[model samples]
Target: MAPTESQHFGVNMSSLEFARSVFGEEEDIGRSLTRGSIPGDMESVTLDSSTPWRLKDLELPPEPIMPLLIEAYFSRFHWYILLFHEPSFWNKTYKVYCQPTWRRRDLSDVVTVLIVAALGLQSVLQDSTWHGHNTFRIHHINHRQLLLDLVSEVRFHLIDLLANPRIEAVQVCTLLSCFYMFHSSPGLAWSTSGMAVRAAYALALHTKAPASQDRIAAQIRYRCWNHITVGDSFVTMIYGRPASVDAAFADLHELEHTDDLTIPPVLLDLTGFSECGDITSKVTFHQMKFRLYYIIRQALNRFRLLRPSQPNTNDDLVAISQEIKDVEASLAQWCQELPSLYNFEDWSLADRWAQLEYSLQNRPADIQEHAEVILLQAAMIQLLYDGAVILTHRPLLKYQVKPMRFSGSVIDSMQKSLDAVIGAALRISSFPVHKFEKHFVVSIVFHYLFMAGVILCIIPTSQPLTNTAQEAKAGVVRIIHASRAMAQHNRISRQTDKLLTELLKIAVQRETLAALDNTSVTGYHGDEAEPPLLDSEMSTTKDVPLEGPKELLQANTTTIYQPDLHREFSMDLPELLQSYHHTLDTGAARNELSDQSLLPSALLPLDPHSVFVSEQLDDIFGSLQSFYS
Candidate 1:
């Protein structure tokens, strides 16, 4: 050829693409052609030819509402999970729905548009102002009914995609996975997410970004794979399933900026944080989450080696102590290196959460609106860090719960685990019920809440209830209250509410039983005994459902202590993470690592050259001093 298109552009190109790289093409086109050819599997064939999930038959929302929905999706959810190319998404969605009766379309593209609009509609409805908007009634379309229909149709096509997957299939699968986790079918969410991960592998997305000629396609591939692996990683963190793409994360570039995530002017005015994009770019949020997941995965790896269910011996437990220190050291450095805006170690977590709640209650004249995205991102990242701390230290707690005596190091590790996990829970439950969207709870936020909630409920039964412990119990109640409010939005949250309430009742009853004769749900049996508080239903703890674990709630296990020791739960988060403990007769005492941090002083190895030069300088200085003398 006189001059190939690849030669002209100085990048490889498919013949049909001509001068149009992924940048020039629409999002839908770019998605299908990421592999540089029209993939046959990308074709959306009929799962049932008789009644396909056809766009014409579905009751799409009024055209005016589409833009509003898309904007809501971007402002509220996009930054949390970087799933789309913002500019390209707008181009593709507008091309499909903006026209009257839409002449041409891809079913996959149409499904994407529909799902985004559905989630957007859900977000908009959260305000309670949109429930009876005239547009929906005037069109004779019920908003709730319309939402159900969109979901049903997606399920129809998802069945086909399950057998014959494509790039867009990965997108839908990821979104649907999230939807199920908190929304409708939480039981299936994990399995659906697993499907999304394998689908990404089918496309070889883990290997590398697919587009060499266009930056947009590269960004999309990176983002697409990020959601898949991160979603998988989160599931692994919570569920302890093996990570499917744990190794692939090492090669990933930080999530690229996308126009789709830009907060709309309406939301900017509403949230009162106009400078959010600049303060903590959405790109930074994703990268922060990505790196956090890597460390969490590493912690899980070390925890697995101990096998809480079946440890070989005390020596086996001792073997991984150094490895635990290394992972925690990594987390400590991760926190230290974080941009100051996200770093929150200086203040007490309880005080910090109270300050956040105060801001929500009484904002300055300039910024009064609630649930700002940037602020919420900071809270979520903090929770992620706290959750990582728990994951790192929980194995020791598990062994300690069993009542076996071991070395001082094991006891130190156990106390660290106990305080970190419980402190994190108190911080989590302390998050004001008013903050964050009522209808939409981010999965990560709720997941950590659940983790912390469990720790708060069970840990205090074994230990005496301090004022801190009582407040923590109240915090768990608030969690129950928050879960109830969230339950109205999704089925699983309702179940979560029921589960947490039951767990709280059991924890209190166990505490009450252990306290005996004193007979107080919250009494610590120390100087000036604290009074019992919260629900009248909890005044009587016996005959409550034995839904919790037998080993935990039923038995007078060491975890359900006899109340001989009364270690007051009074310390900041940094204090709780301290390495040393004030030894107790029962082998469970917590002390602040005040002298030295839990982690080593340095994160990375000292450079040999720097060390040698410093030594050389010391020698020269010594010689000079001696000569002068």
Candidate 2:
């Protein structure tokens, strides 16, 4: 009479039997983030784009495929147990057991919420580790594509769910806030991330989930650490020491309410791992390793500070130099060994370490000569890219259209490559020039120059997304500045602007050609037909074809049909005459009429038919006048 132990655990034997009967011939479903070794009834879940519901060929919710997989796993293994135990838990908490519909929907909602949350969490972690791309010309190529793919996929779900609100919408919304932080494209990381975080906080407050609200707020506060890390590293690396760590940390308080007790822990490598679950241990552990390189960097910085002039030092200076050498040795060892620790296949973690090592090992010199060369490289690339856009009249063609689109995930792949390169650039840019390797500088500068092309092309389209015209202008100006900065050798030549202007002309020409091609206009083309010439003197049958001029000559011989011919051809004749006559009169006829200023009472209107005619029309008109006389 009593239910089995499996029944209490919500393991549905019937469902498992049904799944096995249906899809037993297929291979066993391996480790899925959702299924966890459970066998699946379907071979794969495909998002069919042709359907109105946004997906076809799949009999489940489209966005949360992973969640559906988990749902199936739960139904297969523990449905009977969940059917009994979960009801008891519900009855104890709410004084009534949840109905079957309510229970089913609740599981779906929780699973959806968790999957979405994981995506956001992943984005946040990935972003914090970014160092600004400088190693390759365009952010790390492969990584950028991956990131873009991920964002696009996440966004599709975000848009769909947000457009249709449900009780589970709050968590979906919360997770979306975390997604924006990872968009490292130009200005998006700041604006979109800030909005997402705020939206998450609002959703938490509206849902009356104080704990979720606190947690979300804390996550937002934790983001301040990214800014802090960047600030500390930037200040120390560029200017020799942090201007104010206290001032930087002050931003964290604003992200949270004064009364919230659950604060997100400081996300320095070690604490980050302890807070995260096993599913994300790979992410956590690598971040710890990623942070290790900075320790060596800081020591190297300190050594430079102590010996600014690289002076021949006493025993103390020698001792400090030895310590710096030891740190470098440790860094080199760690860089070589750290890659094997985590699942290197997960691009989210591997990318950060790869970028850090690239920066530390391969950066450029700070000498004026090399900087100039870097500048020239940047200039040349920018000119070429801009020229392409101006000539072709489409922006970001290479990155977005032909090259990246050749890949399956267009936006996602583009974003990943962009992210890696951007992170490297930012990191290398922040470091002191002297510390950078010559090849690294050349390589990074070359990459930025290439990226600068992509960026400049995208900026025109991206400008409208900014809050103000000033911001748009600022962004454009920044690109211009970057072009100038990167193209050092040509900075003084004025060739850059000349190149830009020529590209503008080419762009205009392209547009004109397109319009002509569409409309079939031949007037702009040199090959267009020329108008027939007027009749020659003494030509036969000349009088037979002069109908228009003969008709005009019959009306007026006194006026002679001289007809202001130029005036007849003029488009803005009235305005032109007004200006012309006004100029001729000058100030002589201001108050009194003079001979030159005297106006005719009635002037003859020019007839274009009479003004323009074949030479035969003149002889015909003369004969007509003689007959009239």
Candidate 3:
């Protein structure tokens, strides 16, 4: 028989059968072909040609407003650009915004200006309440309305801007991504960042510079490319998605060069009078950040490749673990090699907080500048380095459960890394709410805090109680408080606040039960040379009740730790640990289970062989639901 069109080098077959054979099954074929494909509705298309927001038809903000917006952008947001761009070029380009005919600027330039102005004004307003600046408040409200209108126009014209890609369009897209991030729209920020990455690649921004290009233009292009690279990696990690650009494909030679460029300092009072080394140090801070992000991206990639869903061999797990260790070592070395100017330890938490408060209350120009410098440097270095530590150690949270003997060093490292995370969170929370509003990177602070809380929860069960265990308990309470404060600015902080509170309760209950168990063992074995029950022996004991809901016990069981009797409740150590895991998996609170409010009074029978697939702590911690809120 002749082969049909759907058949491949085989006998004749029915169309449905052929389709199923070629594309797994009917459903798989449908999904593979239709996944994420745009629908036919014209209104839903972002790139519709008939959209009305043409540059000529757009309404520009008033002339007087432009200078204020420009000033705000330069004062607050320009450092992000100056991190990479030659300062002289930035100043030159910024001059165009001051001109009367700025309306005639390129469409991409207009979009860039509007986006920067929007972010800048929003940042100013977020902090204006702290400074009690009535003038800024009045201007902010009017400019906010203007910003809303401009943002809508930008969205309408974005497709047209990207239709013919240019360097300016790349800049616009990059700044737009930042705008979305600052506005607490990370998904949009991530999507816009992808657009910027693709546009930069299209413009060959990552390619080596051509000899014919002007020196300043080449420098700007290199800086822009580096910015996009770092930004893309950052957004990808924040979203827990794969990176758009690979490190191997990026031309990072310019970033590696140590030669000092005499560019105008973004913070004139801080770096204006410094030597070339100072300028290099400023550039190096960003370069180091980029390198650290690249390391994080690699760690994230390895994690994805070795996730539980995929079939994995012991060899695969070992390789991934080794790779993570390598990244951790590299990160530690990076921290040690940081320049003296970027010393993260120079500013104590108390000192920084005091400086910030004095600057805000007194409004001394020098004090304010000093505060800004401290925050800018501290936020940049501490957040990235501490975040890197968290990312590197995060894989261990899963691997710690494996059958290998628990290593004390692993626990120690976890403690130190968590401390770094908590320290960073404390430093950030000390700043006024408005200071955080300007920096989109502050969004990750919630993740850091949540991860710290998760580690604290695990530490008690994973290792024997010691001084570190005591510290872990104290750390959880501290994080709960910090998260509560941070929740004001970022909504993700609230969800973390709830989660940590719950974890803290579990830790307390577990600790109380463990302490009672120790005391009982001591008194019962008094005058005897017998050692206390091992964890294995404790697991099988029937006398002690678990420190959970009374419903977890049968009707025949008697409660020993009733508060009315003033006795201690006790449980088998291993069973208590198991109950902890069960509660985490099922979200079963002891009070809720006992009161029969959240769960049914009749408990479901447990199947020893049945598996309850709980979500990974890493996934729960990494989710941006709170950030989106």
Query: What Cα-based lDDT does every candidate model obtain?
Result: 0.56, 0.29, 0.52
Q: Sort all candidates by TM-score, best to worst.
A: 1, 3, 2
Of candidate 3, the 10-residue stretch with the lowest lDDT total is 560-569
> TM per model?
0.67, 0.21, 0.63
lDDT of 1 at 21: 62
Best by TM-score: 1
Instruction: Report the alpha-carbon TM-score of model 1 versus the true structure.
Output: 0.67
**Predicted candidate 3 versus true structure: per-residue lDDT over 501-565, tens digit per residue:** 76655654443334333334334544667566666445323334323333333322221111111
In model 2, the worst 10-residue window by lDDT is: 396-405
- Model 2: residues with Cα > 4 Å off, grouped in runs: 1-213, 238-243, 246-282, 304-311, 314-317, 329-629
Cα lDDT of model 2 by residue, 253-292, tens digit: 2222222121123221222223233322222232332244
How are the candidates ranked when ordered by lDDT, highest leading? 1, 3, 2
Candidate 1 lDDT, tens digit per residue, 25-125?
A: 56345454443333333343343233433463566666776677677777667757777887888887557555444322355677777777777766666
How does candidate 2 score on lDDT? Answer: 0.29
Off by over 4 Å in 3: 1-59, 80-105, 129-143, 251-281, 302-318, 349-371, 400-441, 444-447, 460-466, 486-489, 492-496, 510-629
Look at candidate 1 and give me any clashing residue pairs.
Answer: 86-260, 578-593
